[model samples]
Target: MTIKHKITLYSSLFFSGFYALIALFIVMSFASFRAEEFKERLNEKALTTIRLLLDVKELDNDLLKIIDQNSIHQLYDEKTLIFDENFNLIYSSLDDTKIHWTTGDLEILKTEGAYFKSEGENEIYGIKHLNNGKQFYAIVSANDNYGKSKLRYLTTIVIITFLVFLLATWLFTFTLIKKQLKPLDEFHENISQINDLHIERQLATKENSKNEIDLLSIEFNQMMSRITEVYNLQKDFTAHVSHELRTPLLKLSAQVENQLLQQKGENDLFLKSMMQDIAQLNELINSLLLLTKNNQTNPREYESIRIDEVLYAAFEKISHDFKDISIDFSIAESVAETPEILEVKASPNLLEIAFSNLIKNAYLYSDNKKVQVKIYKDNHKLKLSIINAGSKIADKAEDILFKPFKRGENTADSKGLGIGLTIVKRILTNFDFSIEYTFGSYTHQFLIIF
Candidate 1:
């Protein structure tokens, strides 16, 4: 899951737990208050019943019973009974649901003035009443059915409200989090678009914001500025040094060759070796100059060209330079008659340079001085490959093979500057192409997919 989803899930859980506790507390508090309120109402009914029983002298048993049953206010399922000090019944408000009382219960009511007891769902309240020093007890009991029904309804409302609120909170939190992290999403997109070709471009920041994302953008821009400064300086130095050194190196090689031609003595071998060294140095200088151009060249210089024609030109050049090497070249029969398959948009000079490097590497490292070149179309993509019979590249070279100054085990027996493949890869990347290296049991292959 993404960070936004994780944050939303955790925040929903946290808020749900918090709201659940609040709902529970509300329910418990309301239940307690309702129970206490019912108890108070029962006690008040008992007091009122006793007051009428004691103060009304003309009130007979039937009249008192009638008044208790019909006129006395009571809660749902209410019942009442009155008893004298002698434990004889005076009046009963209920016909079937009786409030059973023992002498000890009456004693408690007489001593304490009021007594309360609960039997199952029924709540009973008893009070002692006195008239002319005569003692009587009045008792009331009920289940508070109306209050219980109200509480059930309230409980359902609380539960539904809690669920609705939880859902609303989760949606609101998810939306708010997505809005808040929008900057990070944009930052990631911008970072993905950055490459060495656009190294000088800076990350954008809000003008008046000092948030962490804004600060991060500021730091990234500063870092890119430093990298661009260093990269430009390196490119300039390489180009200038190569241009300056190539002339002297070529002059030195020419003078040494002339000396060897004229003398032809014991020092002839030494002069030839010195001339070879100068030639290798000159090659390195030229490769460095190409590298600088690859780094600084603009993509607008590219135009439509036949990739097959460029490959043939590079192959011919390598063939003329190294006649001892033999190369087998072929075009796939499927595309033999298809001229459009050979066309691609790229810089022909850069393409030829890259192909030349690959051809040279194949020639220098092949054990039998033989290479195979193939061009084909696979799955609507143009595929080109150069295979050479050579020692397999070392496993460690897979990661750093395209890096500058990185060579493989096969290059140990070859004369090279270790930047041939690196330059080839850099040149291809500018044209939206890439190179792949594959090792077979007896052949090394460089595959280019366009």
Candidate 2:
């Protein structure tokens, strides 16, 4: 799951538990208050009935009933009864019957003076009363319908309010967490896009807040500064060293060639050998310089050129170098409706160098000096292949083919600097092109897709 979903889920659970606890507390408190209030009102009714009866000596049972129905606060199923010491009913506010009171109940009330009890939805109480040497007992029973209705309404309101609170809390928590972590997301995007070419770019930071993300940005910028410094120093060292060595090598090559032409003794043979060695060194230096230059060149400097023209030019140069090689070159169009111009965006010089390297390798390694170069259009792409009849390359050769100074196992007898494919790979990668190799039983082909 994403961080946003995880945060929302965890926070919603927490708020649900917290709100449930609050709802439980509120319901319990309200229920307790309602029960106590109702019980107190019942006690008040019993006391008031006793006071009215004692204040008026000549009050009849019918008169007392009339007073209670009119003056007393009426509850749902309210009942009041007064009994003599002998347990005979003396007065009852109810219509027909007295409250069923056992002797055990009366004895308990006599000793305790008063008792209160609740049964399901109703409350009952009994009290012993004594005045002017006469004793009596009062019992009251009632159901608090108003209290029950208020509690039912209260329960409904609490449930609804609690649900709304949970929903609001969930939304508020998710939004708040997402907003706070947006800076981290931006930091990740910026880091993901960083590469060797974009080493100078820095991650974004907030000016108003110096939170964790801001600190991270500041540290990243510092690290990039150090990396760029070290990289520039290394590149400058390579370029300068190559230039410094190339001048002396060129001078040495010229001196040796001049000496070979002037001398006619046995030492002339030695001078010729020296000249060849010097030429090879000069070529090595040139390759190094070219690789460095390709690395530094900007992609925007490329121009459009006909790919077929570039290929033919490279093949012509290679033919002159290896005249004995039998070369076959062809271009076939898969679809007649395709345009004649096989153009692509690239540096012509880099294209010629890369193609020349492939063509030279094909000629040098083929058993019978037989090489085939094919160019065709397929699926809206230009496909070029350099196929040569040769021994199969090693299975693992493809892994290191494009690495600098890496030679295949089949190159034991061939003369090479091994930077040819390296240069080609760098050039093609910079231009968003692709190259692949195919090794067969009697033919090896290098394919370029543009």
Candidate 3:
């Protein structure tokens, strides 16, 4: 799970457990208080019964029973049994319902002076009475309906309150966590868009807030500032070096051409080879310059251009250099019917360079010095494929085919630098395009998806 979800879940669980414990404590404490209070009420009832029966001159058992039956203060299901010193029943509040008691119980009540206990849902209280120098035992039992009802009501309230608070806690935590982490989500999205072409871009930060997230943004901006500085310096160095070397290379090429015109036989052949070497060196320098120039290409310069036009341009350039090489180019019926299907949004110059490199590679490595180019639509996206019948590249070599200065095992006799595919990959990636190399049915294929 994400950090936001984990934090919210754990926090809500913690608060829920804490609240449940507090609710349990409240119910237990209130129940304890109610039990003690009811016990005291029962004790008071027993003492008053004993005093009224023995101490009052005018009140008799029958009159006292009538008073108890009509008393407003009488508890629910109240029953009382009075025993003399000899353990004989003398008084009972309820005539129909008998109070369960034994001789041993009366003796224990006499010795202890007072007792309180619970019998099922009823509370039992016993007391020893002393009047006119005579001992009497009294036992009473009753159910505290009012107190039990209050407890039940309180328990229900606590449960309902706990449920409501738990729901509130989960919702509040989810919303709060999502709100707090919104900045981080934006940071991830913005950072993912940063590339070597856009190295100068930086994350925005709040000026007044020093919270952890804001601090992270500030630090990220500072780091990007330093990286952009270093990147610019490196780019400047490469451009300057390439520019400075071009002048000497041009001079050397002019000298070689002049010598080739004046030489004869063996001397002419040697000068011709030297001229080829000079041309190769000049091509390398131009490639380096072009690579640097592509990095500095402005996104505003990109526009919708016909892919076939770029392909034809690249083919003409390659055909001029390799007169004997032939290429078979075709467009799918569906794509040919809709000219716009072959159009893509990119820098025209960069696309030509990428296409030229792939076409040249296909021509150079083909067994018959022939290349086949096809354009079609796949899954609603435009795709171009350059196929050649050549020695298949190993799986291990395919992985590094687009890495700088890396060549395939099949390119041992090829007369070109290894950065062509690398340059193509960089240009396509800048335009959010992709390329893949695959070999099947004795043919090598380079597929570009736009």
Candidate 4:
């Protein structure tokens, strides 16, 4: 994943974990609050019933009748017992469900004083002392029906509350985090506006945030500025160095040719060879420098360049000096479907130089005056290839073909510098294009992918 995706994913996960923690705290707080409320209700209801029973008289008769009365008695669902001074049961309203503890065991409440209490078998009892050592107790036993319903209700409330908390917390956290990071988004947009041509843009300085973010922006802008300086220096050096070498090379070539013309046939052969070598040397240096200029070039003017025009023009230019060689050009109508199809946005001069160098390389390789240049395209990219008749470059020479000063094993008294291919490589590379050379028994091919 990209950096932006990773940042968003991690930010969301972090907030999820944070929201989970917050939800846990909220759930716990609500549970504690609810449990305390349940306990408080139990205590208040128990005390009020106990006070009402104290006034009843006729011990057994009134107590039995009062235990079943509509108001206070119906509050109980299971066994209920009342006690007189003798500890005999004054009123017994026992259901079919067995109560684990009766009024006898509930005597523990007398010592502990009036309070709401629980009995086994899901029963709750309230006990209170009457005047003269008499006591009254109420019981409510829990059946499966009430227990299941109450449990279901409580569970539903908890789950609903938990879900709501998760949703609400996530939404709220997302909003807050988005707001906090809004400046980062703005900074990224500002940076994009500063193109490769000018990458010196910096984030707006905020007095409140003199932190790591500010440090990052400061460092990033500095790095881009430094990179730009180095790149410009390399380009300028290439152009200047090429121009400087041209003058001395022309002088040397002129002197060598003059000497070759004056010398005798036997001596002049050696001088002529030297003259040819000088000429090739000049061409190589010129090509290498031109390649550098093409690669580093960012000319202001560019338009729809027809592939056919550039290919034919380059072939004719290189063919002018070499009268002994023959080059055949072929362009399929399939490739010429559109005018702009061959039209790449580039400096015409640089493109022409690159094309010329490639064609010249093909001609130099072909000892027999036979070569072919083909122009074509695959989808969005353009491809140009030059094939020449020559001995295949050995495997060793193939590896170092694009590097400066590297000569092939078969380079006998070949009249050229080794930087021709290097220049082509550099030129193609600058425009995000690729070049590949394949050599076979009598054919050498240079492939250009644009």
Candidate 5:
């Protein structure tokens, strides 16, 4: 997962656990308060029942039951019992529900002077009452239905509120984290676009912002500045060396050619071989010069050049070099009628160099000195494939096919430096194109997707 998502998830979980504890505390505290409050109400009922039975001369158990049955403040399933000093039953409430009590319970109530407890779903409150020198025990039992209903309602509200707040916390955390990391996202996008050709480019930074991401951008810019300076120095050195050697090499080649024309002996063959060696050395210098020039060239200077014309130009040059080589070129029928379909925006010279290298490599390595070049539309994009029948490349050699100074295992007999595919790949990649190699049926294929 991305940093944004992970931060949001962890933050939300922490807040959820914290809020859940708070909700539990609130519900439990309220429940405890309700239980104590209901017990007080039961105790008040028991004392009032004992007072009416003892102090009022006209009051009787039968009349008190009528009063309790009609009282507006009556509790649900309320029951009351009274006992004389001798532990004889004196009064009972109208309800048939029995208030279970053992002698030990009554004795404890007498000793303590008052008591409160729970019997199943009912609360029981007891008190020792003394009136006119006579002692009496009063007990009351009832279910606090109203208080319990209030507790259930409060519990439901707490649960609902907890859920709503949890959702809000998650959403707020997600938004805040995404907003805080926006600069990092932009940094990744900008850094991905930097390459050796654009090594001087620097990431943009916000003024007066001192966050870690902004600090990273500043450090990266400083690092790239040092790298660009070193890269430019090296590039200038290589170009200067290559340029200084070219004049002497050209003059030596001219001298050798003149000598070969005049001499007619075994020395002529040796001089001719020397000329060939000079030519190969010249080609290597030229390839290096091309690479340096490509890096220096601005991409904006490229123009719309026809792809077919570039191929034909490259083919003409390859055929002159390899007298026995031939190429079969074809365009798919879907785009053959439209000449504009073959046009691409690129540097004509650089693209020609890339295609020429590929075509030359194809002809040089083919068994029959023949290559097939085809152009077609794939997924609405232009694609070109150059195929040659030859020994298949080994699996281990496939990965290094486009690396400089690297060649396939089957290319030991080929007469060229190993930097051709590397140059081709660099040029194509600069133009936002891609190339891949595939082998099947003893044919080596290089596919270029534009």
Candidate 6:
């Protein structure tokens, strides 16, 4: 069932059961109390009748005569039964055949001052020993008309009250549930209004809501924010990758096309230039793939790495591959006093690829024949800078240089796939590291912070 309906049903059931128990208790207690009150009034009347008629000290028929003559004896609904000491009926209102009067019934006057009770139908009878216990046994019966009516009335009222209470409880509980869930419903509505265009707007998590639903809404919005950030990064990365890869591919394809379509036999120098362009294209493709692979890995697998060692190893690999560039490095040692040597924890292969691309860019872009690689420690952060006497990027180009396939004014002299720095920045970001480019009158510098 839906949460709203489940809440309503549970609320209804809880109130119904509670009201039912309360109704049963009230009806039973009220009925019992009213019955006791009626019985007390009946007893009082019976005692009064016994007191007025009976002369307890005398064994005579004088009181019986007075009782028979009293005009005030109009309150009681009674039948007279007179019995002897031997427990045999002498004078009776009920015929012996009608009641089948046994010794037990005729022995109502057990002593000189005995009062006893018996039930017939819905009325109760109080038999009082009277007339000196010789010839008269006073029988007074009272019907509990008020008591019965009170019970019936109370029973009806109890049922009606229970029904009303049940309805009220259900409505109140369901209304309360709806009130509690209102914020959650609003939270969902706010989230639904959000899409790629509206990613910047966050949900309102009110402080007054000291509850789980509020926390859930806040966390959900945070997740959405992160997703939007990654999505934007991916879009920028894609655009940069396309722009970077296209130039090299076109150059390589043109070279192949020229070789294929030529009528004359291709010279060795022309074929060599074509092969060099093909190699540059292949290198650009490899770097882009490495960037994509790093982003695709399960993030949980990344770990802390020593920046100096990882960079030194990457530099060695690049130096082996490109023998033309004279690469030099100075690395600091890691220590308890110098934990800054370990900049971040990340996938080893990915960091290597990123650093490798940065060093290779300095080599490819440098007009002078040498590249300088330097490493240093600053607190817990590592700073690795690669400097080359190469093309000084334009002031305008600095803005879009990190964007994929973005080339600068100095681009004409070199074969570049424009996305190397973009990939490097992306890979470093995955490891929580950052990159900054410093361009000067004669220096093109890239700094990686660990």
Q: Scored by CA lDDT, what does every candidate get?
A: 0.84, 0.81, 0.87, 0.64, 0.89, 0.68
**Tens digit of lDDT per residue, candidate 6, span 1-450?**
869879889878877887788888888898678656755665565555444434354624455535533646432344444554555544433312232234554455454344434456334443545455454443435456656777888899888888888788778877898898898788878977664335556888877666888888778878988887897688678657856887868777777767766735647567767768777766666655554442544345666677767877887898798877788777666533566545466887778888888888888878876888887767756688888985566679889978888888877777788888888777777666789899787888888876
The candidate, 4 or 6, that scores higher on TM-score is 4
Task: Superpose all Cα atoms of candidate 1 onto the true structure and report the RMSD in Å to 1 decimal.
Answer: 6.2
- Per-candidate TM-scores read 0.65, 0.56, 0.68, 0.58, 0.78, 0.43
Off by over 4 Å in 6: 1-16, 41-86, 90-142, 192-201, 205-223, 247-450
Top lDDT prediction, candidate number: 5
lDDT of 3 by residue, 166-249 (tens): 999999999999999999888888899898666777887889897888899899999999988887788788889989998998
- For candidate 5, lDDT tens digit of each residue in 85-141? 888889999989889998887898779998888899898988898888989998899
- Angstrom error at residue 118, model 6: 9.7
**Model 2: per-residue Cα lDDT over 153-268, one tens digit each:** 99999999998999898889889988998888888899976654456778877777669889989998999999989977776787789899988988988888888778789898
Clashing pairs in 4: none
Candidate order, TM-score descending: 5, 3, 1, 4, 2, 6
Cα displacement (angstroms), candidate 4, residue 281, comes to 3.5
lDDT by residue (110-168, candidate 1, tens digit) is 78988777887788888888867998888888888877888898899999999999999
- Model 3 bad stretches (over 4 Å): 1-22, 52-70, 77-142, 170-188, 205-222, 246-287, 294-301, 307-342, 355-403, 406-421, 434-450
Error of 2 at 263 (Å): 1.8
- What would you estimate as the lDDT of candidate 2? 0.81
Clashing pairs in 1: none
Candidate 4: tens digits of C-alpha lDDT, residues 332-355: 677766656677766566677778
* Of candidates 2 and 1, the better by lDDT: 1
Residue pairs with colliding backbones in model 6 are 240-404, 244-405, 303-345, 304-345
CA deviation > 4 Å runs, candidate 1: 1-21, 31-184, 191-194, 204-227, 259-272, 294-301, 319-343, 359-395, 435-449
Candidate RMSDs in order: 6.2, 8.9, 5.8, 7.5, 4.3, 20.4
